[model samples]
Target chain A: MPDWQELVRQRLSGLALDPSEKEEVHVELAAHLEESYEALLKENVPEQAAVSAALFQVTDWQDLQRRICAAKKRGHIMKKRLHQLWIPGFLTMGLSIVFLVTLQKLGFNARIVSWRDSDIFFYAPWLVSLPFLGALGAYISSRAGGSRGTALLASIFPALALTLTFLLMFPIDMIIEPIIGRQADFKIVAAALLKDGIGWMLFPGVALLAGGLLAHVLLSLRPSSRETAIG
Target chain B: MIGSGIKRGTAELAVLSVLHDGPLHGYELARRIEQQTNGALRFTLAALYPMLYRMEQQRWIRGTWETSANGRRRRCYRLTPAGKKKLTPLQREWAELFHALQRLTKVSHA
Candidate 1:
């Protein structure tokens, strides 16, 4: 008839488990102790002896607390990673598709191999959006406990997807033939692909870097007011 | 009574073997483990719950809260296919270890 729940809560107070998880552990332990106490009582054990026997179960409460907290922390990290990285990464990919379709509607051809001024203008919007997309990714990653490297990697996902798609769809010969026709040799086509690929990627890559660095800097600069106060 | 070290080492297999019978709540699982082991192996809430949570996380066992006839809600743990798959290998390993120990010590089977 001891307040087993309160006892459990007090024992678990130092653990880093969130409120709900702590409550769950509290309830489960209380239930277990209650059962143990009842079983002892059924055998005509004295109340004090039953309580002592029940309490004896957890020989090392400190070790138990550490283990439970560590397990919960790992689970939290996995869930946070999925939410932070993949969700935004996929959303960005969806938005990129919409942006590409809009560009096509505006009479901007995506398949042009030439580095004409018009071609540059056509690709400019996609390139311009990359920094913002990267910023979004980095911001989310930072919020989810990701390091600067993780943020940078997350920011680069959309660009990586685009690059992979282009390479998969059009080989150098196929790409160059459409732009320069038969006048372009394999070497010229290869050179153009390399040059244009880098050209298209350069701004976006910088944007990703800038966004990741900016997120990291901003996060590091901000005071961890809550943790500080708690500590 | 078995040493805590030995008890803890076999805790997972013990729980899995008991749960192979059917789903049981934490209290029932602990009670059955003690009863079946003839009080040699006993699990405290501190020791058992963490292992249960770890096994649940590993997808070996699944826990679900169910209301008893008395309207008390308790989390019951059941063996998953994954847990069942693990039991045979674990049993074999323990058997091998016991045989080796018996051979080395010249001890008869208890």
Candidate 2:
């Protein structure tokens, strides 16, 4: 009888699977062939006929190999994308929160409220860091097979979070205003909020756009041979 | 021989129905499916294994290694709760499809 395990390993050699995964497939195929061969022999079949019958089950090994490798590659890419994009994005957001808390502890809030000449100084630090954070998110997303839209969205995660928080807090602030019996210029507060929101997002948005353009240039310059050759 | 398109569509239902009763290794599953269908539905290893792996990935079925009485190790596949949940709807769809085909063909059931 032919060495079924060796035959299975040879047939599966073209697959791009990891070594352990390939070995598992090899064992499964070999075991399948062995069982089929034994079952045929039990029915009084000759050894040569049994071997042929067992091998006949794998009618198109090439097609099988192609499909298996394609599936494995897709799985690998998805896993890589999840790790590369989401993990770093969340970490960056967490670090930004810590930086804000540190600023508050350093009495930055008291200085901002006492502003006599300029309001921009209150947000200068955040503005300076926003572009780098956006660039980091865009770079990670680009490296993980994300499109331009994905890169932009990833970089704007902090903005999205801040907007969502403000939306949720707006109702509570309105309810507490009458209870506190404090009336301030609503128009001025609204203007400042709008201005600050725009200021906070301006650098990050520009950075994301620049990062996306840079990614596009870098990608187009690379050779196309790295892409999958098979359909 | 069954056409590849129809075979592919029905393969999942057939495997799930057979495995609903108990777990079976690859060889035994093939043998039982062929035997039960009177050779009408046959699965080549190349076609069957890939589908099995895909379903395993989907959490529809789980495969575990077990040693037979003869001390030979085999990977036996059993239907999961998820697979069982999906089986009823799949069977219903196939029945509906069969009825539609029968109606269109104007052929009475044999």
Instruction: Tell me, by DockQ, which candidate is best.
Output: 1
lDDT of 2 by residue, A79-98 (tens): 75575557546655665667
TM-score of chain B of each: 0.93, 0.93
Model 2 per-residue lDDT at A83: 51
How well does candidate 2 match the true structure in TM-score terms? 0.67
Candidate 1 backbone collisions, by pair: none
lDDT of 2 at A214: 58
Clashing pairs in 2: none
Cα-lDDT of candidate 2 = 0.73
How much does candidate 1 score in TM-score? 0.71
lDDT of each: 0.75, 0.73
Native contacts recovered by model 2: 0.47
